[model samples]
Target: MVSSSSVKIVSKCFVKPKTIPEESKQPYYLSPWDYAMISVQYIQKGLLFQKPLGSIDNLLEKLRESLAITLVHFYPLAGRLSSPEPQKPNSYSVFVDCNNSPGACFIHATTDLCVADIVGAKYVPLVVHSFFDHHKAVNHDGHTTSLLSVQVTELVDGIFIGLSMNHVMGDGTSFWKFFTAWSEIFQAQDSNKTNDLCLKNPPVLNRYIPQGYGPLFSLPFSHQDEFIRPFESPILKERMFCFSSETIKLLKAKTNQICGTTSISSFQSLTAVIWRCVTRARRLPYEQETSCRLAADNRARMYPPLHPEYFGNSISALRTAAKAGELLENDLGWAALKLHQAVAEHTSEKVIQMIDQWLKSPFIYHIDRLFEPLSVMMGSSPRFDKYGCEFGMGKALTLRSGYAHKFDGKVSGYPGREGKGSVDLEVCLVPEYMEALESDQEFMSLVSL
Candidate 1:
């Protein structure tokens, strides 16, 4: 077993597209939502793959070749985030400089660690950082010149593909789009016999949200057009708890019995249980108001209805609230009902209202609001089929977010590997709170260690 103390970097280099796609030559506009994200690097996602069907060198070569080909279709990733002309004093339009830029940094590293060394550990995996490229601090422009970066780390028994993308560039939806494309290219061996690769479904780049939303400058939130908060040290501990198909079924059935209705989904049921447990574990006062923010993907809910391939931040923040007393005192159904209603309220018109609101004030409400007590934000999708990414290799052994998710109270859920109605919760909380959650009898009963 490789000692957990050190992971060695073998090589590091930039891989630009063989030729910049013509479409990428123009500057891609940043919508109000995109602009809200410029100051914070909110998302860094990663995946771990076991042995592929080739030698380590051959696999790395194919990965690099396929990545170059894939960058052609997703050209925006190959560019840098830039600020243009002085529309106002110290005020400028922040847009992606897609013209000429060095492509993403590709990192190759080796770790004596095994995949199981982290994922299989008893204490909880804090080793997610081993899979990422080096994070370079931003320059004076207050924007990261690097939009996308890749780090491929070789473990004793597997490979980890870490992708780090700026939130301003796009959201999780955009990240997954590029991920799926790279996966396809890798599987098909993007470099054919002669080595030519292109995306079959090129992203329909839509910078504007189909409304007269103002660009990033119009937002009233930040002064000098930026917020550069020092990176506070994070005190986070993550533990994965798997809820089997049987437990979920029981939760669903129990929730229906408590609510006298069966309309709530398994997701709603589990979210309610988690909220209640977290609220109680945090020891918030009975009267304290606690909220769970469910990220609503609005690709299909927009007015014109964005195509599934439409790229950009397409998230609608949906929230459900309850006092700690009411949350813990009542049967789980009440919380489920609140959560269900919160999600159900996001009709097409509601999405348009959110759009217009951003047009009015382009700032993202959730960026700096994390770490607040009594607030929990949901971060991924069990239904997004994250399990399907296979690049000439077996599927990922276990896919998880980077260490950036260590913010207090951020909760992530994905379908369990058992597949029949199972769910897994990757919960990050204070050490004591996590201990409380682990000791929670009702909650622990449903969790599989």
Candidate 2:
């Protein structure tokens, strides 16, 4: 946790759009994927920007203005959350009340910390949490809770924009769409062609029609307790492992040589390496069933291939399960092939079946249960381009999921700063396991300090 004294919260308030969105005065029901997280709170993320060229106050005012404008277009973000059966405590059929929200939470904060103090170093303290709303992480603030909470923190060297959006409303893809929209609005004020600017594809709020998925039954299991052991501990640690383009090339080549196939991608290769390292470091039993849950984006794979602007949760993960000895003793390509096949098998028909199965089984049966011991899950996508979200100030040097997304046996993947074939992984785990991974010679040799 970040010390309260480190970042001073100067002011906090809600900012609505310059004009209300007339089209969304009614309640809208979220899809099954979105509603599944109603009890989990928002998806928290942060961005790092180099110091802007103008006065801090002016820059903030511009941001506030742009945020209001952005909300007009992304009206769903301005909605409040509610369940269809308010009296039923376990009801997971939650909906977004678009007519009731005042606006999103916006905070103006200042800190003495600098970007250099946190960005590159392996052991920077909890600066990311200091920027967002910690109170709302596990509990709902009130009935009028803002779907989105954005905090702007200023330091001597740079600024951090932290976002906490209700996961029931959107996933990373939708969040980035709104973020990029806000950036574009902020930059259009100074751009040469302000009127000509337009988002590539406007957000489509209609729930994606499941072609083959049916006979849903998730509402009853929604009452089950959330599987939260992986997220809790006496001490939670976060670290970043950097893999350069050259290292990734080497890894891909190694995987190809080991698997006797030339089709492995950078993601497949790197995840395989980390999966093996984690399993070896944990020193689990030879027969222990270890699983690597790889996040698979379902946007381009939908039956109709929905547009990138299609909002809400469109993500599905693939599980690659194997014995500890298989991963620890076998060639890297063995794990790589498992991962590659798992991800490759998530076709349109497969996603529909997955949704169907999920609706019939326990809520969180597939994803959250996989968080049990001896399992690793990967998060976020490098394709979303977190670094490309450039406001009027500049492009983001780095962006992270922070503590909001951290858990033991979890890894977050991000594109390298240069956007080459490189990848950046943020790893979180128990202290002993981290110590074990730190000492693993093979893992150390492949990573850039």
Candidate 3:
């Protein structure tokens, strides 16, 4: 047996867990976004101090004891979707290491550590940094999706841990809940209160079941075919661009005036402009039905607050459409109205009914067909900036969404609260499309401002 005295002490943090009601158990398939969060975890290590150092193994033992319940919770599903079950608590595996690098002494650097790498020996998973490197090469044609894989290299000293999860499992909120619970367990152990870490009850398996289903919505078979097909040089290309808050406001005001509509939302106006500009740049046939799908948070819509501690997937998509020429030719107000109606229709009871119908269908055949042929996916989540990620080390210098290449292009929007009420947006498009947009003086003026 591993001795508690053998592990060393390190920094402590918290990870909360996601809890679902017992009744909703079977119909839930992990969302791709939820799987993305499975890979992130905390790193713990020791820094230089005047007092004597403790055992690293002992610290890990305490951590293990505190996290036993959570680990058990995740263990059963480890390989359910990916591989076979791991020999140990693969969900809670920890690593230790020692470091004596150049920034050692005056820097108050760490030497002993425990990381959260959970990938088993057989699966050669990529790291987050490496994933970013790969993202730089391919332009988003709006048809691709990307996953972030994080490996915690050091909990202390030379030891490192890796956590690999798919995006469909959960979003940032769900992930943080799990993270906080993990930290709380470590803290309880540090203070010799291991008993407090025990869970009151095991998680109840709550599966979702859609009522009366008859092929509810149109599935994207054509899109799936294209997804599996080798990447033919896309006829279109995507680019990344930014726009200032002031410019967006000015554009919105102009659009409101042109369409003579007082109820236009910022999202509708901005998206209308983007669609118009992009289509104008590419000079594509204007008769096609250009579509855009937005990711919507279902937290408020769900019955209970989906237990903030529940660390699994919890989001849905709302699709919007606009005729290419109509959007390009109409005034901003008219375009915004059209866009708003489309988005609103997507969130109605009928839409939810359709989603329910889709989920209740046979899993293997239904899910594969549902997500095919999505043209563009767009979303906005400002929680990253609002979350307390400070950890006593000043705010993060940068925060970015992980890459996605599954659609023709992806547009992620963020609240530009840092500077006025302008929205900060990130648009991922194929290189050729991006270039064409950039070269246009009118579009450049809007984005550059």
Candidate 4:
């Protein structure tokens, strides 16, 4: 096991854009959907890689240079959150101040641990959390904090590139787009190409404000301090369980057979299995209500359809709930149907209606909302191209998350390193539930070795 003590900080600094854009003088207003995440923690994720054969100093400088260029197109990320402004009596709103941007934070660290120390562990090692920066920071803290922080942790035989992005700035789609652009720029320079970095699909920086709303809609909180959600670290266990293509095929077949329907997707089927097993492990009362909250992209679901590369929070949380006993008692196909319906029903009209409702009465997601009783919250998607993040060394060995936004029932889904319809789930739960989950034969039988 790798001890947290084995990790040591080497250097830390802010890496600004190579040049400031004149348009950055104007503030980048956050949309209503962005404000919904003000109380939650930043997104903390990283990529593991085999050690690059070169001086660590050279590697760090190359990454810093490319990131600086990448920020020019995504300048809001380099900006700080503006101080809350009063929209009316006892209400406030915030925006990103791109003017005089302080830039993204970059840290270089070294660890005595190796790739095997992390990838081979039964439970994610505590030291893995050390690889990422901004551990306890919420998105509200972006005013005086770095909206983005990149940490490069040098391991004995590998490197881990960990990143923390303010949720107010973007969702996973936006985050990965920035990562991809940075990689593209770096690869161009590595091949001794011209300085003009040609991004395939540049980020769409314009904020989307709903019609007939906002001169700045009043936020729910009267003051900034109230936006900080109370979070006490719980003793938790996190394990990555892999589902191979064959396993997923079996799951889809089983679910379709039981539900007597062929419309349920592999993603729905796999998530259903997790929800059922976790609820069973919790051993809650038969009538207790349980929920599974999935983050759905609203870019394509919106009227006129937002650019696929929209660079801000354009996601809506879709929740499905059922009685604990009802969920476990029903066949897996029945549970999958609930999720499928949730996805199917979130059409353009519904997305707009929800946005309109939020404009009327804003509800900021807090720690309590995240850790709903007897529930699981699923974030991230297996569709995110985690393996494509390569900085000339090679493709990522694997993807992992840090300590932020993690609670008893938080689950992050990822595409398995192996291609061909495989899946991986990073499940976090309290010790008792984790033990029960790992021991549950019904759940473990389909796990890929």
Candidate 5:
């Protein structure tokens, strides 16, 4: 077992883009979507790979070089958050200060622990958190902290590449797009190809401002620390529950049969099962209400639809509620239908309406406000190409998240290692609740591993 003292930092440096663009000299405007996530913690995700044949120094050099090249296309990441109206004491507008911007923080660390110590653990080892550079930093910290940080941890027999991106910069889709592009650039160079690599669809850097909304929106907080602090999480246990393709298919079928409708999606059905099971394990009162919130990708739901490559936070939290008694009393299809309806109702018009509402009174979303004893908040998606990222060695062996945004009932979904309709749910809950969940036959029967 890897302990708190297992990992050691070897070296650290800042990596700037090889060629900074003239456009990068100006401030990068942030949209309302970006502003909403200012208080949230940075997204910490990492990929594990088998140790390739090369010295650690050589590998680090290539990663840094390729990363520098990658940043030219993602210049905003190389910038820092700053208030355009620093004179205003009551309020301030935040934007990416690309001019004289410091580069992304690059960290190199090592651990004697091997792959088995992590992937094979009953509960994910706490040492997994050390692989990331920014431990508990929120997005607003980007003002002084690096907007993006990359930590490369050399394990005994494997390598872990961890990335921390300011949540305000983008959502899961945007994050993966950058990762995939960086990998492509890295692979091209590793294969002795030309460095002038053209991405299939370069990111559209144009910031989105609703037609009536102004480019600059002032936030209520005068100081960054006042808006966000390092989240002090509760004592919790994390476990990855895997559901195979066959299990999900059966779940979908069961849901459709119970709902007397075939419209419930596999994702929705799976979510329903988790929500119901968690509620059951919590043993909440029959009269008490419980909610499940899913992070809905608004890119497709927006009017005329945003570009597939439209980077930045394009997500909305869709919350569905039902009495715990009713939820537990109801069948899987019943629960899934409630969730399905909430999602189906969020049409393109509704998305625009949400933006308009937020524009009227822009408020930062703090996860603390939404958390409840029995509530569940699901982020990330199984649709993301989690295993596709290959940083020269091979495809990622597994995907993991750091300590950021973790709380009881927080569930993050990832495409299972086996792929093809499989799903892995990283479920976090209070120790007692987790104990109940692990012992629940109904839930354990569905978990493949």
Candidate 6:
């Protein structure tokens, strides 16, 4: 197991939004997506469990005190979006609420596993599900806003803590940093040595200052419609899948052999296979069609390794085109190569610089129609297992993406460190396509290997 000290902390300085008067001085306006992300930095969540010798009230008091230094922004819509600018100050307040009576705060001091378990299960879904709801519409202010909510639920035998935040506020990396800090505070308070914990500097906020003109600059739609609209939907479903680590390694090795190309990473190869499998199962026409886009995190490419603590939205997308037939007909090597090229070309400094420019353009949103329908959203090599799984009771057997709406396909893959060549992939596809792929002998063989 890795020690917490070894984990890197990202800076959070830039996450705080400047006052309206301060922001008006700048010539450029924050893209709608960026504006929403900035608001996420001010929100916070805490988990209070009943330990063998602990009182829940004591824990809550300690947590409230410990978090005093950080600003806590809250909204009334527990699972919906809130306007960025509230008509009145203190329109919404942040306070703890119990499951039995959500409007009233509950402060109980007890230690019970059953209580913890029920709370944990409920909290998990509550925190994750809220994001999808908030993104669907703008708040009362007419500006698109995101809400942050905290729910306390009972786990199977212990209390589970859940935090829900808007994606526009911060990306996964930034959110993780906030979580780790919160955990550290809780741990320090539990041990009665809060002063020993060191607080790091916050992240620097560098607005996407446009560089030379790129694709986003001449786009056909508004900035809000481009990135935010893709994620809007009223309802969503969640699913989870687990694969033995050994199976993933074998598949990667096989892909390397078939592709005859050492340049492809395991992630690219796996995504290509999934794309082909889904398309074939759906019996979708492949000729001259581009049906998918990959959500690539631009962290490393933008500034070497991204600081985990740097909060706010710092991501970009890469578009790929291929006929369904070509992907299915190609060997693993060919598919892997195509995937690699599609991803790699966009990793260049030029591409990132171009994206920064496009986001700043007033016409950024107008270009959405030029692209093909985005069928799948894929993210590879996430470090879920290595993150905070240990803090929650038993080790997490599997980590999967929460339910998401809007997109027809979603998949995330991460390496399993314990097993040789093993990878963990969580896929979300339409029921029909999922059923067809499950029944396909060739597709099953590839995934199972």
Query: Highest lDDT: which candidate?
Result: 5
Error of 4 at 428 (Å): 0.4
Model 4 scores what on Cα lDDT?
0.87
Tens digits of per-residue lDDT, candidate 4, 74-106, equal: 888889988655756668778888775668999
Model 2: residues >4 Å from true position, as ranges?
Answer: 1-4, 85-92, 134-144, 192-197, 209-218, 221-234, 358-370
The lDDT, on a scale of 0 to 1, for candidate 5 is 0.88
Q: What is the C-alpha local distance difference test score of each model?
A: 0.73, 0.74, 0.41, 0.87, 0.88, 0.44
**Poorly placed runs, candidate 6 (over 4 Å):** 1-147, 197-238, 286-288, 303-309, 356-360, 363-374, 384-386, 389-406, 414-422, 443-449
Candidate 3 runs further than 4 Å off:
1-149, 152-164, 171-240, 248-263, 302-311, 363-375, 383-388, 401-403, 415-422
252-315: candidate 5 lDDT, tens digit per residue: 9999998889899999999998999999999998999999998899988887788888889899
* Residue-level lDDT for 198 in candidate 1: 51
Ranking by lDDT: 5, 4, 2, 1, 6, 3
- Writing each residue's lDDT as its tens digit, candidate 1 over 1-449 gives 23334677899877777667676777777776676565555466677788565588888888888888787777777777666556555344666777667787788888877878867875555556656653423221224456777888888888888888777667777888888888888878733632646566778786764544443454443254355443433577687889999989989999989999988989889989998888888998888998898877888877677788877887766887888898899988999999999888888899777667756555543344644565887777776666667776766877776655456788887768767878888888878888898889889988886
Q: What 10-residue stretch in candidate 1 is worst by lDDT?
A: 134-143
lDDT of 2 by residue, 306-330 (tens): 7767888888768879999878888
The model with the greater lDDT, 5 or 6, is: 5
Task: Tell me the lDDT of candidate 2.
Answer: 0.74
Please identify model 5 stretches exceeding 4 Å from their true place.
86-89
Between candidates 4 and 6, the lDDT winner: 4
State, as a TM-score between 0 and 1, how close model 1 is to the true structure: 0.91
lDDT of 3 by residue, 49-144 (tens): 122146544544454454443443532222122212234441211110011111000001122222222111111122222212123222111112
Per TM-score, what order, best first?
5, 4, 1, 2, 6, 3
- Number of clashing residue pairs, candidate 2: 0
Cα displacement (angstroms), candidate 4, residue 24, comes to: 0.9
Residue 307 deviation, candidate 3, in Å? 5.8
**RMSD in order of candidates:** 2.9, 3.2, 13.1, 1.6, 1.4, 10.4
Q: How close is candidate 2 to the true structure, as a TM-score?
A: 0.90
